[model samples]
Target: MVATQQTAGLSTSGRAVQAVALLLGFYLLAAAIVLGLLGLDLALYLGSDHLRPALFKIWALTAVVIYPVLRVVFLTRRPKGGESGGLLVGRAEQPALWARVDRLAERTGVRGPAEIRLTAEVNAAVREDTRLLGLIPGKRHLEIGVPLLIGLTEAELDAVLAHEFGHYSNQDVRLAGITVAGRTAIVHTIGTLHERADRQQAEDAAELRAEAEDRLARGKQPKDRSAGDGGVQRVLARLFTRYARLYFRVSESVGRRQEYAADRAAAEIAGRDATASALRKIPTLVAAQNFYLGAYATLGWDAGLLPAPGQVYGGFAKLLADPGRRAELAAMGLALPEREADPYDSHPPIAQRVAAIEALPADGRGTEGAGPALDVLHEPERTLAELEAVTLVPEAATKRRVDWPELVAESHLAHAREAAQPILRALTGSGLPGTVDALLDAVDRGEGRQLAERLPRSAAATAATGRAAREFLRPALRAGTARLVVLALAESGLARWELSWSAAPALVLPEGMAETFDAALDAVVADTPDTAPLRSLLVAAGLAPVAG
Candidate 1:
């Protein structure tokens, strides 16, 4: 029995490692493909017969020269150098921080002192080598950016450090540091390229718009209008737009995955809840820091818009004072807080991260915390069996059917009309009597589906709307199917839509229909022979199946 148990444990550990390795492999493969494509595009563009090789060479050379010059200008124009050494563990003058770090190191059984570092941003990282002059193995270093240390409470700070030490103790810190360095380098390269492309795009757009306007002014038919003297401008605009989109999309994807990996590592080191709390806190600190920096820059005190020293610390203090603001911010995103620059985002949305973490079992065991973190983590086969036993029923037939009038009344189409009322009233008040009313009435009663059918059907519109419905609306509706059924009946003339488990004639009652909609959906789908496929479809749509 002991030997069997040991073998089972080894097998589970091996699987966990395989899972993480697979994910990392996929990421590297994607990065390589993207880089390859980019290289190919550059070669083709530069070598094209239509474009002179010498001219292309000169342009590339000029771009290379301009990039660093702009980078230096941007960096130099920002605030000058601040404190560069490790930020003292606690308060600037407090000795308790170091004491606490010593205690944590002793508890974790990791060698080396924690080398702290201060930065405006809220972050803590474990560096393997602290001595700037030489490489040192087994000499681990910890840097807690001042902002993060100041933001977290003593316990929270300890939790953060423990999490870092978890990496060190597990011998994962070196690997993580290497990954970070590689990602940073890639992101920086992409960022530089994106910036240059954006600048070029702005210039190209202005030139194209001017040329198009000029052609229009000359009374040339729209189709007859040439690109004018800005052929190069038009090409550059197209190229830049394509590059900008590709760069951001790829960067955001990679960034989100890296964040997940890091979060998982942190959770393994610290308790899940503690890690969650730290993730929640950093956003508010960052926001506060940003606000202060903006204010400082506006007042001409700071050199640029970046956060000032101690700004995050001040922000944390404000949150401590205003509990309401703190709660609001905490609730903003459970995993990853939203930021203004989402295009260049290097992390997943907070809500997604929270969901992922919540999915983990309570315990911190398992390789990279990928398996059930709960005590007695279930075998994969057992887990599958359990899931199969908890069969779900579709909502459509289980609940009462909605009538056409009620559906129309409760739909977003009606909401849009209601929203447009004020604008129409304002237009009428401004002396456009009777003009806005006709438009408003026409819009309010417009049947999107009917209009779609009547219009000269474009294959493109059909494909696009189908894709949108499948990709976006279907999932959204499934997510809130129960609430949607209730809401639909409540807001409509319908009255009877309740969920039911048994087979029954689902009626579209004028009242109380909301209570029956779930039952109606289940009955409709359950009667079908291919219940398994039907249930899968409903699940994909985001609906919960009936208990029966």
Candidate 2:
């Protein structure tokens, strides 16, 4: 990407300073809003008489407005830096990864994380348990994603790690906790206030409904009245919500600048080209891993089957190795991803980040040649298995595990069987035996159109009737019949699903049968149906009596 001046006029270090100031300002303003409301209410209560209803009402309303804020301030929850999610990898378990972390920490001029954890996300992160609003820095923790370890080159991995460590070097990690804590508390308080308002509104509606019912029963006209409920809570929520938005904008603006500083540090630690390359590949790698998981790894999830441990996590490597899939991913990697402009976007666009690195001179302490980042772990397979165990959902972990080949066959067979079920049900509803042979008999007897009409069709298929309906139903019928054929062939040991690493599972048949499999099924379900080729196929496979 060509470097631009408009978006990045300030130096990285200068932006870091400005972000620190904004963060401080955000906190100060938050404190002022809460204190200002409370102070005003206190003055009115202490200085003014309590006997006046209007004056007392004014004070009470002010108190209600400040109530949520007061709770946020005094009853704030302390930040536990590393609590939820991620499996903690002890130094003893993976000395190689820890050694690299320690080396990078020294280079970045910051102490390494006290604990390292592995997570299922696509990015790396650092967090500090800063005490007393970042004044006292406590335990530091680092989280590295499994995908990053498996997908990136060693230097690319280092660049990512360096960027996270940059937050520590820039002194932003300590204070980021406070900014995050403030946002969490503000958002929580607003949500609590809204819940209270909703409950009160529901109660008021129920009370009105009861009154109307009573009036209707007594032969009297129902009267209209205002609910006039939850007004205080609503007002309080609105006030806090505005403050929360401001806090988000200011803090996140700081967050964006901090990201640039971190990226700069990454570039200095790793080469400019390496840093830029890592930035480009991370998004694409994330996309590929997600696609692999949804399309391949969980194919048999409905049938309680999973890729054996390590395979679930390591299957992504197979995708990148495929020439066709690699080209697609490379194209995806070249373009920086775009999305709806959000105020809380904490990182600069990848294009801009890469361009910034491009502008820098080649002056980095980059290490040796490229290798898989997974090399950093001792016994990578064992570590990956452990990662899979921790990352997979509890139910997924309990699923029956199988090798990739068997997993593909079993999963696809399960899907085929499931798809055929609807057709069976449709046949039974029409006073038929609902067997494959019964379906063949009905089609042969010219009941195909009637049966097609009875089968479930999409709204688009709604317009089609008579001959048109049969045409629309052609694909569904053929698919159902194909499933039946595959089931029979498998039962008789004539066909099987062969694993294809680059594509979907292949339904392979015997030498002569493989070539005619599709043509046979098509001939069997054509508009003017012919079951001879299909019946011949069954006979050859030794499953006799195609139509019973």
Point to the candidate with the largest TM-score: 2
Off by over 4 Å in 1: 1-94, 109-114, 128-141, 169-172, 176-272, 292-312, 330-349, 352-548
Q: Which is the leading candidate under lDDT?
A: 2
Candidate 1, poorest ten consecutive residues by summed lDDT: 369-378
- Write out the backbone clash pairs for model 2: none
Residue-pair clashes, model 1: 41
lDDT tens readout by residue for model 2, 60-113: 776666665556544656454448477788889989999999999999999889
Candidate 1 per-residue lDDT, tens place, 1-548, comes to 99987875564345334433443543454355445555665777767777766766766755554444344322323332233443333334334555666777777777745355433356676666422111124455566555554456554565567766765555444443333433443344445545555666676677777877887899864343333433333343344345445544554554455566556755665557666666666677677556543432122212112112222133334433456655655665344644443665655666666567667778643223222111111232332222222321232123332332333223433443444444334434433332322322222344212222322334644456654533332222222223333333334434333221121113343433335445543432221212233234334434444331
C-alpha lDDT score of every prediction, in listed order: 0.45, 0.78
Q: What is the lDDT of residue 231 in candidate 2?
A: 69
Backbone clashes for every candidate come to 41, 0
